[model samples]
Every structure is written in C-alpha cells, then in structure tokens.
Target: MKFSKRTKLNIILLWVFTALPMSIFLYYYYPSQPIDWSIFMLMVLLAIATTAIPIYIGNVTIFFSQWVTVAAFLAYGAGVEMILVQLSILPMIFRVLFLQDLPYRLIFSSWMFIMVSFLSASAAHIAGYQIGSMDTIQILLGATIFMFVSLLSNHVILYSRERILGQKEKFFSRDALWDYAAGLVTLPFAVALYVLQLTMGWLAFPLLGIPFLLITYVMRMYNTAERANIALAKASAFGHELADRLSVEQIVNMFLEHLKNLLPADNIYIIDNLKGNYVVMRALEDGHEMRIDVPSDTIKNSFIHYYFTYSEKQCYVKSSEWVHEAPDFLKNDMNSLLIVPVHRNKKTEGLIILTARKKYAFEKFQLDIVHLLATYFAVSLEKAKYVNAAVEKSETCALTGLHNYRFLNKTLEIEQNRLNSNPHLILSALMLDIDHFKQINDRYGHHAGNIVLKDFAKLIQKNVPEDAVVARYGGEEFVIILPQYTKEEATKIGEKVRQTVEIHPFLVDSDLTKNRLDEIIYITVSIGVSSAPEDTDETMSLLRNADRALYIGAKQAGRNKVAEYLK
Candidate 1:
C-alpha cells in the first residue's frame, strides 16, 4: 500500500501522539516488584514465536500473541506486559513493512499496536487485577476485561486510521467478525496458562506452547494451499480468454491487463526479439502505456541481454543486487524485478519484465503465476501468427505478389459503403492494360512475358500513393483504388504510371535454351480513371466506367495514354 505524502504525514503525527502518552504511562506505572529474569525471557521468546505465525484473514492478520501477553500480565505487572507486547511487535513490523513492501504500514501498525496494548492494560488494571494472585474470579474478570478491551481497541484504531486516510473501508465486515471470534477462542488458553502455571510450574509453558505452535503451523499450510488454488483458477480463466484473441496486438494488451490485476507492478515491459535484436514492443508504466526506443548496444549491456543469453527466469528482491546491469529507464524508483522469458518451441520469443518500487515486492507464488501466463501468451501469439499468414495467402497474387482480384472486389465494396455513409468523401479507381502484350509472348517466349508482368506490377506499386490499393485485375490488366482522390487527382496518378511504364526497361532472357543473361525489353500501358458520385454512385459502375475510358479514350486514341471518364 502506497500513501500520499499528506496521508503519511498524518499517520506520523498520530503515531507521535500515541507514543508520547504510552511512554509517560509506562514510566509512571513501572513495576515496583523485582522481576524474575528466567520467566521474563521465557515470555518474550513465546511472544515472538506466536507473533511470527499469524492467521491471515483477508487483509487482516490475527496473532495469538495476545494469550502470551495476558499470561505475562497476570504473572508479572502491566509494565512488564507492555514491554513484552511491544517487543513482540518487531517480527510483525518486519513482515509487513519489508517482506510485504508496504511502507505506510510501518507507522500505522506500530501506532495501532501501541494504542491497543495501552488501552487494554489500562482496562485490566482498572478491573482490579492483583498481580501474583491466584483468585479465579479476579483472574477471569481481569482476563475478560483485557481481551474485550484489546479486541475493541484493535478495531477502533483500524477504523480511525482508515477514516483519517480517507479510505472507504467498511467499519464492520466478515473479517472483523472473525477477529472478534478469534479473540473469544484464544481467551480460554490464556486463562488455562495462568491457572496451570501455579500448579505445573515450568511444565505449563510446553503444554500450551506446543499445541499453539502446532495449530499455527497447520493454519499456515492451509492458507498457502488455499491461495494456490485461487491463483490457479484465475490463471486457467486467463488462458481461455487469451485463446479467443486472434491478433498479436490483442493478446499482448490482454496479457498486460490481466497481469496488472494479478500482480503488483510499477512498470511492465514486453521486449520482443526480432532476428536476434531485442525491441521494446509494449511498455506499461504507472498505469500508462508507452514505447521506449533504446539503442541496440545499450540494451545489450542491460539485464535483458543477460536473460536472453542465459535463458533463465530471474527474480531480484532488491535493486542493489542487479542495479549495475539495469537499463537507463529502469534505474530509478525500481527495487524488485521479475523477468520471465516467453518461450515457443524451446526458443525464446520475447521477455516480460515486471518491476516494483519496493524491495521483496514479488513472492514465489507470483513468480509461478507469471510463468504460467507466459506459456499461454506464447501459444496464443503463435496461433495468431499462423492465422494471419493464412489470410494473407488467400488475398495475395501468387505470381505478382500484389493484391488479387478477390481482394480488390472486397476493398471496393468496403469503400462503396463508406462513400454511401459520407457523401462528401471521394473515391477513384484506375483500370490499366498492357499495350500489345501478346506480342511479348510471341517474340520473347511465355517465361519472358511472365517476368515482364511481375516487373510491371512492381512499377505501378512504386509509382502510386502508399494508401492506394494496387491489385492484379486479370490477365494483362490491373486495377488501383485511391480512397481519398477525385477524378483529376486519379488522372494525374494514372498519367504518372503510364509514363514510368513506357520509359522503363524490362530485363528478361529472350531464350531459355541458351544461358545468355540480360535482354532489354520495353513496354507501354494505357490507363483510365473514374471517381465515385461523379461518373457513378456504385462500385461496379466505377470499375465499368474506368474500363470504358481505358478502351475508348486511351486504347482507341492510341496506347500509352491516360484518360478520365467524362461525365
């Protein structure tokens, strides 16, 4: 949990206010009786052990150390009990602040524990708890007051902190109920320890400590298994969703979105390896998407190169361990990192780098989840690649490598719909035919004619606007669709293509029987242009008008000329 600067300052002020009173109270009520060093040490150790194995319920952790604190309070006085409880809070602080990478939790948790301890101890003292007395009624009364005050104060502090931080957490929840129930359940154990200690002496500690430790261990294992099951269920659902996506861009976007939900990260980078050079394909930083273009040599000197060369997954808990090899973009405010290589058929396809602003931010379970997602991502990407290839094959001309007639028809239909929706939009079409093409085959063989056709396709493609769709219309004929061009503009482009083709030399071998390489041949083309809503409102009429102009205005007027359909 990160907090705003104002929230952090408010929490620090709250801690100061609570700690000051607690210090003064402890000073005034310092234990007057001589302390038993052995018993004190035993209680401290037991408190530490119990605090370490807490039961997690949602965002709240329930520690059994309260039993130890109550027992210490009954045997020694409030002064000793407060010290013991405060010392026991160290392990929890370490776990929440460092292990969990929650910086704001350090101040909030410390103040919360102090407030709970002081209020509960005050309640027990007010209830007439006489230290070293074995009266069962006083014992039960003091213990009940202690536990009740502790539970209530714990929630009160939690609710207060949340309110102060301007968070919308409910005051009452199922987890809160669990906290109260857990407190009730642990009360008897504290009573038993206090009563049995007078009878069994040192034997009482083991009798209670062993079973407490055992139960804590069992609950910890159950929590781990439950979390694993939940994570696996999410991963299975994510994999199914990825399978439904049909493009690489969609898969990458979905992968990053799902990953952000499943894990905590400050920055996520998807680096693609194309022909042995790493390129940053997509990057998500602080909830925004961007692209980072770094020099190849700069990337080579970073940890991305290390992962490619080694082909092993890596998780660094602290930036200091790997800072020297980090790229420039990742050098600031990034502490933890998990890098997983996306593999397809035993070869590394790309790399996924997840980074955080705090140390030890990623756990082992999160690493496992990332590996599973990477596998799913690779498989989906491969499927989309093959599907795209198949679609490209169906729409491309095999000989000329240009859009085939089928694709041309589909494009014209799509453009016609667009023109119908927007009357102001312009669309133009060009029909082109090779002049005396049969003579090329008769004089220079069919193979030479095929070479000339391929060259002619390349020439038209090069001479047209990039957005223009050039297609092989049929044998010795080609079509071009200019989406935003008028009749005048289309005629200009048609003239350009006709002039280039007339002057260009087609290189082909005149004979296949002899190995003579270079034979120069020249060809000319006749072109006609038509615009939608000017010559006709429909797609078929647009092509028809262009063809009519090609034959009448260009072919009949003499080949190697450009003409537009006259309305």
Candidate 2:
C-alpha cells in the first residue's frame, strides 16, 4: 500500500517537529551555572528518554514501550565519570525499534550520523544564543565529544545483541561483549586525556569528560541491547517449537498454558461454534494436555462474541462473556477467559479462549502469540475441510450434486453379489422417465427442459428411501436402486416418485424468451419396478425387465403411473 501524498507530507512534518525542539533544547536550555554534575546525568537520561519515545512510537505495543522505557532509563548512568556530559541513549533506541539485528558498525554509523546531526544543530543554536560571548568552537568541540561517545555506546549495544543471538556481522565479529563495550573503553581514555590537558593548562581540559561519558553510554547500551536480543531469541525459539507442534488442539493449549506466564490463574478452552451450540474441544486446568479437536460452536461462540466485541483490546474469558452451559469441565473451575478467534479468509473458524485463574493471568505478549498461532490453525483446518469436500465430490453427481452412477453401480453390485449366495437377500430397482420429455423440450426450449430435469432429480430425491441410490441414467431418464426391498416395497416407492413429479410444477420459458418464473407447468413420469428373484443372475436383466415394465405403465395408464414386473 502506498502512502498518500498528504500522509507522507504529514509524517515529514511530525518528524521535523520532534527533531527541531530536541536540537534547540540541547543547545540552549542549560542552567546558567558553570556545571551541575548531578543534573547532568538526569538531563542525559531525559534526552535519551525523549529519543526513545519515538522509537517506542514506531514499535507501538504495550510491552514494547514498557521494556524500552526501562532499558533507556538504565542507560543514563553509563560512562558519566569519563565524559563530563551524560550518556545519550537515542541511538540504542533506534537500533532496537527500527533497524533490528544489524551489524554493530552499521548501527554505530547510523548513530554517528544522528549524533553528528544533533550536535551540529545544537552547536549552531548555542552559537546563535551568545552564551558568555564564547566562540562557536568551544560549544562545537564539547558537543563533538558527546557525539563520539553516544555513537560508540550505540555500537556496543547493537554488537552485544547480535552476539547473544549467535550471529556475527562486521561490527559484531568479536565474541566478547567487552570488545564492543567501546562506550566504557573510551570513557577511561577521555577522562585521562581531559586530566592531562587540565594539568598542562590547556583551554579544552574541562570538556574531555564528554568523551568518557560517551564511551560509558556505549558500553551500557550494548549490554542492554544484547540482553534484550537474548530474551527475544528465546521467546521466538519457544514460539517456533510450539508452532511446530501446533494443531487444532496445541494452538489453543499454548494460550491457556501461558496464563501463569501472563499473570496467573488462567485457563482456556474452545467451544465448537460461536453462534450455535457449544462444542468444546480443548481445556487446560492442571497442565498442558490436549485432545485432537476443539470445543463446540456453542462454547466457541461465546468467545467469538467477546473477541469481535473487544477486538481493540486483549480480552480475558470472563463468566459474563460465556453462556450458562459453558462446559462441565470448565464450569466453576475458572472465572474469566480471554477469547481470541481463529480466523481464516476473514471469517472466524475456531476460537482460542484463555481463562484467568487469577486477575490478569495473561499479559499483552501472550495475546500476541495466540493471535499468531490462530493463523496457523486456520490453515490446517482449511486443509482438513478441503480433503473432506474432495472425498464427497468423488462419490457425488457433478450435475445434481448427488450420488453419481459410479457409486450406484457399486452399490447394486454389492447388494446383488451377496444376494445370489444368500438366496434370502431381496433387491429392487425402478427405471423412471419423464413422460413426453422431448415434446416439452420442443415446445418450451432446452433451457426449460434442463430446469425440469433438475426439479425432476429433486423430486426423486425427496421420495426415495434413505438407503436407496437415485441416479440420472441419461437425458430425461433416471434409476433408483433399492437393496433389501421386495417387489411390493419397490412399487410403493415408485408410486411416490411418480406422484411427486406429477404434481410438482417447473418453470419453462415460452417461444419468445418470456419470463419462466411466472409460468407454471406440470410434468409426469412413468416408473417400472422389479425385485430380485432367487433364480435371477444378471443385474442388467433386472434393469431390462424394469425398463420394459415402464413402457407398459406409460401405455396402459396414459398418465403418471408405476408398473411392477411380476415374478
């Protein structure tokens, strides 16, 4: 998706607003005194926090903001002894939130660019302010030292993160965190240089602490970045393992398993449907055990309503969100659950309901992982549904979506092949045809004839016995094979089908393509039924006899009627 021109313009405007104020504040908003060392650390922490806020804004998750705030606040106490200025954490923030898992040198280069940009703007602003009438060189040089340390510390942290993940890049090529702790390394050297310059009576001695502070900031940022990457790697690895085992059950169990990980006292289950009856599939009360299927829709729907209603927020499965008959296993065992519907192709297919055994047993990250797993579950379920539909299609008629001739043939063979040996097994078949079907096609049109055929199919379907096989044989002709049926039973069913089609009207178009829906027309059919005899051998012979009886019924009754072949 392309961002609109207006949206692109607005984002640029917002970036300028944050960057300009930060630059101006760093340049001119200091106290009028020579130095306040205590507040230096505080101001550095504040600067880093301001920088990190944007990074957090980009990541935009509750957990992301929380962890970033904690890490950036901790980075303030780094390298302040060596560098007179406080350590800045802006670069680490960018690496963690924007350019993730990159080389240390690349991270440092990006940080160097950011720091130089900020320092240059701040230096210019400070010169514009005319503070104490000092030359511009004094402020620029001081900002330059801070900029170097900030860049170094940013590199160290980025390297540390890469090292924890067992990855080596150009900057993170070293195995040890100490090698990349440039912020800490530069701190001692900068302090020593500043001391040497001060003892030798140089004018720049007092500002060398900025370099020391820069180095320590780099050291701390590297440490924090490395630790976060380690934790993130572990979290990701665990997720992969869970997903590898993910089924309809494992996917749901994973969410319920993490209630203790979230807060505590959380349980979860899936009911089969969201809007219909309750079909519970999996439940977790004691440990991470799971079955093959999820719960019923009745229980699942309660969670679905909750999920759709509270999509904006992470939800817990509460008693209020569920129905009265939640589940015998889940009822009274837990109080609340967070419902996450497993959706595929934009519609909910299953539900992931996590219950809170205690208050807020699940945190935000738990919900995130569950949502991810839902996608995988949906894919698996879709495969299962497709396999079932394919199996059904193999046996069904392509035109009418009913049992095809192949299945009917197989059914007749099975019934007769056994009946010949048993001598007691009875079988019957009805050969039926639409009366004057060709005349109707000529009178109305082939299109009307098609409607008549489809309706005729439905008519036979409604009248046939549950065990009977009804199939289209050819144009306007059909066959009904009934196993374990005597001649009398077959004749009764033939009559039922004969009457159903005789009364049921079908829409047929007129000669001029007029509306068929308005016109009503009736069609009749003749049926010939024949039962298996103890001496009967060939199935085709029985079919021939029934077909002959059908011709006789049509000629004698002169209307819709059924004729049975006598034994």
Instruction: Indicate which candidate wins on TM-score.
Output: 1
Q: Number of clashes in every candidate structure?
A: 0, 51
Off by more than 4 A, model 2? 1-269, 272-329, 333-341, 346-348, 352-377, 387-403, 410-427, 465-468, 500-507, 512-522, 532-545, 548-561
Candidate 2 similarity to native, TM-score: 0.39
lDDT of 1 by residue, 1-567 (tens): 457788778777887887767756753664424577776787788889988887766556788888888887777766677678778987776544333326556666766766776788778878887777789999999899989998899888888767876888778888888888888888998888878877887778888888988988898879867876787899989999999999888999999999887777888999888887878889999779987998777778887897887778888888788878888877466788999999987988788999987667777787888989999999999999999899889999999999998899899889989989999999999999999999988877888889999999999999999999999998899999999998999999998998899899999887654665668989999998999888899988999999999999999998889988887
RMSD, each candidate, Å? 5.0, 20.0
Error of 2 at 117 (Å): 76
Q: What TM-score does candidate 1 get on C-alpha atoms?
A: 0.77
